[model samples]
Target: MDRLSNLPNHILSDILSFVPFKEAAKTSTLSKHWHHQWQSTRNLDFNHLYFANRDSNGDVQLQPQIFIDFVQQFIANNNSPIMDKLSLTFSQPGDFQETVEKCITFSVDRKVKHLKLDFSDPTWDENDLDGLAHPMFDLPQSFYNHQVLESVTLFSCKFDVFGFKNFGLLKSISLGWIELKVSTVKALLANCACLESLSVKSCWDMDSLSVCGKDLKLSSLVVEKCHFLDPSFEIEAPNLNYMKYCGTVVLFTVNGTSLEEADLDFGPEFECDESLGDSLYQSLNGICPTRALTVCTYMLQVIPMGEEPTGMEPRLNVTHLTLRTAMHNYEQGGIRFFLNSCPRLETLTIDIDRSRRICNEYRPPFEDKFEDLWRSSAIIFRCITQTLRKVEIKGFKGTPNEVYVMLYLVNHARVMEKLTVITSSEESNNRGPETFRSIAEQVYGFRKGSENLAIEIV
Candidate 1:
């Protein structure tokens, strides 16, 4: 019987596509027929540089000639069909213009379906900028010839204004620290009619134009730290379902048939400005007019903290709620405003970071001057009686003020089933076991009748 381990060449080559090139190369010693089967494999993955030289921190530098020789030899030696995917990394400090061009050429020639490159050198200097000017390494006509190329990932690479004019069938793209002109970005998106998922991060120099396309069928779009994108830019895609935006006030317009979830983390550009919030509110209204929206905002220093919740309407039925407040600014009325606004809120998570000030001291009583302070301190969740179930408190200290907040939750919330207190043991911000024990004891003292309630301290 033929050994299963020694499968036919076609089957063996198919399996080799999943493993790294180096590991597949080791199989050559098994038999004469298996000697060059690795070269014919359809996928080439080069992640062994770090694995091979873990102890050497100086640098795992690979000469341009070494890479050129390997690719040329692999293509020449292969007698079977061309490769389907090519992923490579060259983090060396020296100029690799020739090597980079050759790699791109091989992908075009082999009809690679997926190409990923991590060519960024964090330690690179002005000397390395010379390579960007080389014609061979720049965007070429061959890139547009690879009709089967479905996805591409580029890091710290320069592209022409029309770099994506050829990728008409492209489905997904991820770019990091790459510079592209405003018109180039718009034209590229317009060209990728089938592009579904796009991620752009830390591209500081990108243009400020809004993105829009007609035949675009994107489902997930994530933009982080791409501050150059327009704040009012509207993306018109009916098929998009999930989106996440952070570090910018950019608004997203969802015209899709089904949008299940969306997360927005908007911070003001100016330290004391509320304009970003107003812009975000207006942008969201334009995108999801009739749909229910779950909103959570991180209080940035520049954006004046909202005393009352914004964008509250009975038309948008918000279900899940979370409020993360600065330790010192967490007043009782802030909690009240949230409970009153989100009437349909089902689950609420309140995270309080109290590493700075501890408000356990009590002032002398009998003064009418402390009315506002008392009302603010009494800002707890006694009003939220229905629909609220879970309460989680992070960085909980055993202070009277914090304990009062917990007690208020237990006393008021009718459907609460879980109350968790998570504390750290680090000296600077550690909340000792004594604090936990006190909070747990107080919870049990008040919740003796409620068997469904659970209080865990970790």
Candidate 2:
């Protein structure tokens, strides 16, 4: 009786799912029954780590003969075409252009349903930066043409030639640290009519990225740290469920009328001609009006700067609100101006650094008359019509001004539920644990609320 043969089919398949396709294929030599078992494995992971070395400088060098022989042997040994998940990470220097191309060809030929390529092989030095671009790999014109490609990830690969049209059954594509033309991006979206999720990270030179599909069902879209594309990339997908953009600024118009969630990162200097801030707010209201919103922006002066926000109709309700503020001058006017826009906000998280004085700290007889100015700022303005449930204050340092703002929230918010004060080690605390404890006790000393506010000092 063969020891490996005793393992259940599902258990063997699960084991094969983790091992590299080449290794899985080699396991066939264990027995005649195992010969076809490896070929029947649905997951393939072609990694070069088993055949690579690092030099003194930590640069990776791969054994070409070992890798090449593994690929050839695996391809020839695995008689049946049963590849499902494929992950190939080449960590060596110098081009395995031909070898890489052959691996992709083999996967395509075998109808590999999922493909992930991380080409960190330092060997790709363009003969000339402007050399006529060609795709590093090619597939059969009808390759995987009708086969379902569930998930695909391409990192640092040339996508100038073949794209989504070659795989109409693609559900998700993650382009990480990739540089491709606008046309290539468009081609992928157009070809993959049923694509549900697309994530692009650190890809440069694509600002005006556009997506158009007829029966498109994009659920999640995340673009992070990619730069230099026209801000107004037209996205015409109706079923977009979640969208997140971080570290990159866009000045483009989005047409996702059915968008449910959005996380946009913007700063002060980011100027939008069409008023991106206003457009975003309005667009959110138009779709998922009551959805939670998390926006981070640096303070530009006593005035929170950006495009002068276009007035919005008070129709939407915000569930979660976070503000990372920068104060150029310690005037309460900036915070007031910023908070004035978020009327229906229920939960508030603030990280503030302000030099402005709080009014309660004012002394009599004109000695500290400057405190009156801080009191009269927009913060104390009686303008909130909605109920605020919770406020979390991170990096809360015991400043008279900071305490004043905290007091204002405590007083004004009609239905304040809880206020959590988290202080970092960097914040100067002369009394250490005693100081934080005393500060926590004194936070709500000047203000009143739901009587359940909790302050955690860390």
Candidate 2 displacement at residue 135 in angstroms = 9.9
Tens digits of per-residue lDDT for model 1, 284-307: 555553223333333322122332
Residue-wise C-alpha lDDT for candidate 2, range 173-238, written one tens digit per residue: 898655656787777776777788999866666746777675778888887766545655566777
Give, for candidate 2, the lowest lDDT window spanning 10 residues: 357-366
What's the residue-level lDDT of 297 in candidate 2?
A: 39
**Whole-model lDDT values for every prediction:** 0.58, 0.59
Cα lDDT for residue 32, model 1? 75
Stretches > 4 Å off in candidate 1: 1-85, 91-94, 108-111, 123-137, 160-168, 205-209, 250-259, 267-270, 274-297, 300-316, 322-340, 349-383, 390-411, 417-458
Clash pairs of candidate 2? 94-123, 206-229, 207-229, 207-230, 208-229, 208-230, 231-251, 231-252, 232-252, 330-356
